[model samples]
Target: MNRAVRIGVQIQPQHADYKQIRQAVADAEETGVDIIFNWDHFFPLSGDADGKHFECWTMLGAWAEATSRVEIGALVSCNSYRNPDLLADMARTVDHISGGRLILGIGGGWFQRDYDEYGYEFGTPGTRLADLAQALPRIRARWEKLNPQPLRDIPILIGGGGEKKTLRLVAEHANIWHSFSDAATLARKSAILADHCADVGTDPAHIERSTGVRALQGSSPDDVVGDVLDAGATMFTIGVSGPSYDLGPVREWVAWRDEYNARQG
Candidate 1:
């Protein structure tokens, strides 16, 4: 089936109290976003390096109870932080809490500080990718062995743009492949992903194309975002940071998504 155009809001859990982050999630859902995401990290990705930050999966568990409509998850959880089986169980539990609205967005670990402070091995990039490759199947296996199974088959959303191992893993495993690329780069990488999909005998279209977008004030998002749509992307996400966690851009993107989907229909 052709994927619908959707908007996701990544409410970055940095420099803000849990109260404010929770409110931002409420506001994002109220604004009609299809998904609400938080990043997986031990510390802030931007602004004040030592800023207040929340852990990823625990926040997702809270979001599952707090939200009723929008899908909730980490924008991409780091694979190195938890055991594959444990992560699978966590995702399954959250799926049940959300009544099956979880998207397990995961990626090979980055952010050395997270590893250093958390005491996980700060492995090389190749090692990290290899670990991710090994973990995906184990996670699926554990999901099957879980007492109740998942509420449904929780969708796997893999995030990254590496042409080598990452794209290959997306072909083998991901239901959604999220990329951080400009329109031109997205187009190129997408073709590469398709080739990888072909090698794995998975339909490229079956893997929903996802990418991050920045909403500029007074700008018509269609030109930039439409170019990405033309490149086969359908799920567009915009990140909103805290202390304040503004949802104005999320509202704008949700409006665009509705209009875009309506026009497509």
Candidate 2:
């Protein structure tokens, strides 16, 4: 299927007060983003090391209530933080609260600080990926047995670029696959993902390709967005930080999405 181009914004839930974050979310929805995402991290990924930060799922619950239009989720939730069944239940609850707008974007844990401060074992990358491999099935099964069940199917978005394991998992399970790849890298990895999908008897087109694009310093969206589209990504995401939470670039990308979707149509 030829999916329509979509725009998403990751409102970094750090370095600002909740009020500021809430305003950003409102602004993003009002400005016409299709999806709103926040990262699942205990600390700031940028700026000061000891900056103000908030927990992921709780804020998602709030976003579920705060906005009525855009789909909300973590850019990628860490599989190591909570048990798979519990996480599935949490996602189901959020999906209900949002009236069916939750996207369960998850990944194998990566940040060491999160694990260290939270008392989770800082396991090796191989072990972490293995754990994620084990968790996906349990999460799906839990979703099936939940009392009320998710409001919808709860789109599963897996974020990572590991060609061997992560991409394979995405091929096997994800409704959406997200990565931070340039056009060339996206093309290569996408081909690899297609091969993985073929091996697993999945139609590669069944998974939406999503990637993060930086709002270039003083450049038009046309400069980079077209290249990414050519690389086969239908979902484009931009990361906007808090405090100011500039939406100028977001607006531009939204316009670009409209134009692109029109052309596709």
Candidate 3:
């Protein structure tokens, strides 16, 4: 089945109180976003180096109860932070809480500060990728062995653009592939992903293409969104940060999504 265009909002949990963060999630859902995401990190990715930040999965558990209609997950969880089987159990519990609306977006660990502060080994890029490769199957296996299964077969969304290992993992395991690439790079990487899918015997079309967009409220939809769609991306995410989480851009993107999906139909 061809995937429909969808809008996702990532409410960055930095420099904000839990009250404000909770409100942002509610507002995004109320504005009609299809998915709500938060990043997995120990500290702020931007702004002050020592800013207020919240942990990922625990916040996701809260979102599962707080939200009713929007799918919720991390934009991409760092694989090194938690054990594979434990992560699977956490995801499964969240899935049940959300009544089956979880998307397990994960990636090989980055951000050395998170590793250092948390006492996890800050390995080389290749080592991290190899760890992720080994973890995916274990996560899946644990999901099956859990006493109470996940409310649904939770969708796996993998984020990264490495043509060799990351894209290969997308082919072998991901139901969705998220990347931060422009149209040309997206097109090139997508072709590489298709080849990887062929090697794994998985249909490339089965993996939904996701990418990040910025300032959706300021751009002409045709010029900004049309190009990415042309490049084969259908899930467009806008990330907003801080104490005052804004939903104005999210509403605009939701409108754009409706218009685009109508046109596709």
Report the C-alpha lDDT of model 1 over 1-265, residue by residue, as the tens digit. Answer: 6678989999999999999998998989999999999999989999999999999999999999999999988889999999999999999999999999999999998899999988999889999999999999999999999999998889999999899999999999999999878778988998998899899899987889899998888886686585778778889898989898878877878888888788888
Put down candidate 3 lDDT per residue, 1-265, tens digits, no spaces. Answer: 6779989999999999999999999989999999999999989989998999999999999999999999999989999989999999999999999999999999998899999988999999999999999999999999999989998889999999999999999999999999998889999999999999999999999999999988655576566765778889999998999998887877877887898789888
How many backbone overlaps does candidate 2 show? 0
Candidate 2 collision pairs: none
Q: Compared with the true structure, what per-residue lDDT tens digits does model 2 show for residues 162-241?
A: 99999999988999999989889999999999999999999999999999999997887788776778888889899998
Residue 179 in candidate 3 has what lDDT?
95
Best by lDDT: 2
* TM-score (C-alpha, index-matched) for candidate 2: 0.98
Give the lDDT of residue 36 in candidate 3. 96
TM-score of each: 0.98, 0.98, 0.98
Name model 3 segments beyond 4 Å from true: none
Candidates, ranked, lDDT = 2, 3, 1
Candidate 1 local accuracy as lDDT?
0.91
lDDT of every predicted structure (CA atoms) = 0.91, 0.93, 0.93
